[model samples]
Target: MRRSLPVDAAPPVAVGRGEAYENMRCDVCGSGERDEELLLCDGCDRGRHIFCLRPIAARVPTGPWFCPACAPRSKPVKRFPMTQTKIIDFFRIQKGAEDVEAEKCGIFQDVKKRRKRPLVMHKKRRRILPYVPTEDKVQRLKQMASLATAMTSATMKFSNELTYMPGMAGRSSNQARLEEGGMQILPKEDKETIELCRTMQKRGECPPLLVVFDSREGFTVQADADIKDMTFIAEYTGDVDFLENRVNDDCDSIMTLLLTEDPSKRLVICPDKRGNISRFINGINNHTLDGKKKQNIKCVRYDIDGESHVLLVACRDIACGEKLYYDYNGYEHEYPTHHFI
Candidate 1:
């Protein structure tokens, strides 16, 4: 017979064998080892049901395995609560009303001193025109002259005065003679244009002229005369035949006047061939370091005598000799600067 085992020679306690001694329940499913197959965590000896494993191991892991909580690689995320003092410091709340009152008083004193000084109007500065290559300038001038000639020819051919006489199917004899002779009697001056011109003459200034110059991006409009903000820059008046035919997203150079919200009532104005100084007003895209916009003008639609007109209104005080700009995309903040020049 074998000798009796010594008291210290008894086997060490078997981990997760029975609930009587180990009393181990799965951390995941709360099932004891006697009720189901369990994996005892090698690190903390916590029980986890075999079926409750996230990936459901086919068999016990070859080596020692840990329960989800006791895994060496698992980390618990810690979050700290925001305190009232932290918020106050972030917002820089003032602690004293006396400091604020003193600051206000200083501002008031500065304003009073400024009011006592003699009022002096700021002199308008001169805008430096961009230099263009001689060849490019000549080509552009030739193109402009050609376009003007074509426009003049078309105006003479379809003279507005040459209308059908009473009980006649064709133009009046005098109109026919004027057309056949190729004589273009200048149409009566537009009252609006004439009145604006007179106003400029009274101010000892001539009407502003459009000058195209090569800039960093491309050719752009520059005014020869200083134009005041909110003043009538120029008027674009023409027959419906002169408007653009195609309406689409690709056409940014054209301004479409929405007579009504309905698409059928929309009027598209294309100033590509003919327009006033307003056409030269570029869209605002460049911004200051703080994202402040430099746009000083806006396009407003006006209805006069059953016709639609686009007027450039001064949105803010524009300095003289500054480049004119407006929000072309309507929404100033959401404009796609990449699409603009």
Candidate 2:
């Protein structure tokens, strides 16, 4: 009295050195039916339904078929630790690598013709500068297009700065709310560095950065050039919304913007609809012993122009090709990062 499901014709088996059918069950659907429809990953040795793939492979792959999670990725992030005193100094904008001599920093050895003046920030609005790729025009266009495509998966539009959404306090009107939450105003040097990044965009320059897709970590940012410690990496930007409104929000990347005495008045940054490169950064695993060691970037919140703004700053010197990572839940530990590497 039961009808059987129609099975597609058996396709050619792939030549892979994976484990011989441990359970022969589809890891995605937990189905044992149609043994021909399952393909074991060469790396993880897990079976996946052919139809469960994004592109839906017609037949078994030629050599290896690694699942999305098991694919080999390159994002060798540094494991530098920032001391508590240094973090307090960062909040106050006390000292930075901009004060050191670039030539003597030993980051780039080819800086013999540069001037000795310290990098000074200007007074301007915060913005995300366009990344100028050190490649030909065609390649630049390709990289830009690739970046756009990578971020557009969630229907996100490229934004250089934060967008004020409805139900959120106006930017300039949030001073009292932020102050009520023990938030301090952004210091002058830190404020100017933000403008410097925005100004650099106007001059067709940017902080040397690159975005790469990793299997285990998803999309991650890497330094395109040698960078000094305490450099402003980028701002964690998106639509600003009140915490009370987004309590049940399904967004996974929402960052806490402001925490107030009243739990209902807190603000969170949601980068789902619009965002910048900061949206792609991965978080550190604070639950493990090696967690703090993997974070090279620091996520700090400051009241900029009476509005809560989050900035990612480098805690130590970063070499080119090194991936960037920060603590999602710093000392407060709001979010869970046990699953993260």
TM-score of each: 0.36, 0.60
C-alpha lDDT of candidate 2 relative to the true structure: 0.62
Q: Model 1 RMSD to the real structure?
A: 32.1
What is the lDDT of every predicted structure here? 0.41, 0.62
Question: What would the per-residue lDDT of candidate 1 be over residues 1-341, giving only the tens digit for each residue?
Answer: 01112234654366765454357676776756443356666666666665566534323443446666667764322221234343223223335435534543554475468569886799743221111112343333332333223333222121111123343222112221222212222112222333433333222222343334333322344333344555444444222321223432233355544333333433444444344344445665544422226676666554333334455555654453555567666622433443233
Worst 10 residues of 1 by lDDT: 126-135
Residue-wise C-alpha lDDT for candidate 2, range 137-254, written one tens digit per residue: 3333333444454565556776667788666745543443444537767876456557656544333233577677665566677887777777777788788877787755556678
Using lDDT as the measure, the top candidate is: 2
> Which stretches of model 2 miss by more than 4 angstroms?
1-143, 167-173
